[model samples]
Target: MADPKPALVLHLATGGEPLLFALTTEESGKLAGKLAQLVKTGAVESVTTKDDSVVAVNFAHVAAAYIDDLARKSTVFGMHA
Candidate 1:
């Protein structure tokens, strides 16, 4: 068998914003479509990535939201980006 295909994960948001996720990738085309919808609806920001770096289109908003989200989750030691 060949190696699994790398996911085409688009950046959603980062910096511990609430209700945000890292390198978002849906399992199927259907899920991808839904994700695109979310982006269009302002539920998430568009992320562009190159190599290991990620950039968020709505950085300030996303940063605040993510920080809040991580505090609430409190899975700091358990989760890795």
Candidate 2:
């Protein structure tokens, strides 16, 4: 079998549940860089949730973003893009 893909879990500063996203290791890293760029350039208006929803998260609202290596074993549970 092929290697499993990586996944990421984002924790927002808001008083709600955390958000989970399935992405390759490269993608996750790229997102981190992109977030940093957004923070610096203020180029992003909103972010798209992995669950097909749009959320408006400014730099201040981003509490943290983590790469969930353990959860990488599971891939979208039969869902698609």
Candidate 3:
């Protein structure tokens, strides 16, 4: 029998536009469960897959702060690269 296609996992953080961070995925469901557990600790946007790669982004208060800071930093740096 043919094998099932791998799924890309993604975790969306709260506060901003819900950015999906690339996470790892496998045939087993352990990673998905783990992601759920983490999301329970804070406001999680969603869980998704793309191109057969798991993606997970932490959406805690610290995550929001970091994203904001990162945006500011990028703006300051400009689109050089």
Cα lDDT computed for each candidate against the true fold: 0.36, 0.53, 0.36
TM-score of 1: 0.26
Ranked candidates, highest TM-score first: 2, 3, 1
Per-candidate RMSD vs. true structure? 12.8, 7.3, 12.2
In order of appearance, the predictions have TM-scores of 0.26, 0.45, 0.29
lDDT of 3 by residue, 11-64 (tens): 233333434333333423444445444545765444444345443444463232
The candidate maximizing TM-score is 2
Candidate 1 residue pairs in backbone clash: 16-66, 16-67, 17-65, 17-66, 17-67, 18-65, 18-66
Of 1 and 3, which scores higher on TM-score? 3
What is the per-residue lDDT of model 1 for residues 29-76, given as tens digits with 9 covering 90 to 100? 323445444445556444433244554444333312222122233344
Weakest 10 consecutive residues of candidate 2 by summed lDDT: 72-81
Candidate 3 clash pair list: 8-49, 8-53, 9-53, 9-54, 9-55, 10-55, 22-55, 23-54, 23-55
- Candidate 2 lDDT by residue in tens digits, 14-65: 6466666556565656666566555455444454444545555455565655
Task: Report the Cα lDDT for residue 7, model 2.
Answer: 51
Indicate which candidate wins on lDDT.
2
